[model samples]
Target: SLALGPSGAWSRCAPAAATRRRSDSDAVGRQAGMFPETMSVFGNRWAAALLVAAFLETTRFTDFQTQLGAPPSLLAERLQTFCAIGVLSSSPAERSGSERSTYLLTDKGRALFPVLVAALQWAQQWFRAPEGPAIALTHRGCGAGFTGELACDRCTELLAGAQISVVAR
Candidate 1:
């Protein structure tokens, strides 16, 4: 097994031999023994958009539909996928009875916040907007604008791609 060195910055784990894609595959690859890498849980672009909405506490079906302008079918599929993967929990909106269901992020889902934050940071840095970022997150305790920092979990130091090294199993 390839060790992550506590930082998990191993870009070399990318599916180097992956070629033209096919349909309905867990991953778009034929690389042998490609498991246990940085697999994208929500591979769909819309999935990320929906996850951002969920992080902001929007859980109702209608809310997701309205906010995302996604078709009912696609949205339903993604939501079901998230629930099936234990990333989101679905429950009745009403304790007694309700026609609608509500979605909540599970602990596993909440763990994706760091990944989301890092992606947002990268996007903000590269994709500049004329009016600045659409959202600016502030640290509650520190009271300062916050952005994700890529750090080494073992050494507790900031990381760059150049500082990372990947090993093959």
Candidate 2:
């Protein structure tokens, strides 16, 4: 017979050493490449939105500037820079009268959304809400509200600040 701890009683339990080792290796690999090289590209709201808008749908230069309330020249400059970086593909619209160019996210830009989500979640935790959350996530299956809380992927527990460490070389 085995003694149960204060948490609860369980049947037989076996520690899986091999599985744990593999998971640890995977975590290390991710951490090694965690920080991005082109932080300047995502430093402003318009740049971030350029990526987000592309992710949401195909957008024209004028429409993007209108949506973000940014100047047309600035929007054009950022779009050109993003295209240069291979984050977005920009080309003239097919319509003959269309003066605006369309922007679409490449695979690389789509991948940055999760990082943006994490940043938003962190902001929500530390910043005061004037009204409420800017956006809310709902679970499609269960209809439960999902606040983007950073948690340990393995333990399914919220991570403490001290537990997080970053290394760059």
Taking all chains together, each candidate's TM-score versus the true structure is 0.75, 0.60
Give Cα distance to truth, residue 66, candidate 2, Å.
1.2
lDDT of 1 by residue, 34-119 (tens): 34112335455566777777887889998887767666766786677677666889998876767799999999899988887788
Worst 10 residues of 1 by lDDT: 1-10
> How does candidate 2 fare on TM-score?
0.60
lDDT of each: 0.65, 0.56
Candidate 2, residues 27-105: lDDT per residue as tens digits?
2223333243264355444555555456547478766755555566666666776776667887788999877677887
lDDT (C-alpha) at residue 89 in model 2: 85
Q: Which ten residues in a row have the lowest lDDT in candidate 2?
A: 9-18
Q: What is the lDDT of residue 54 in candidate 1?
A: 84
Q: Per-residue lDDT for 164 in model 1?
A: 91
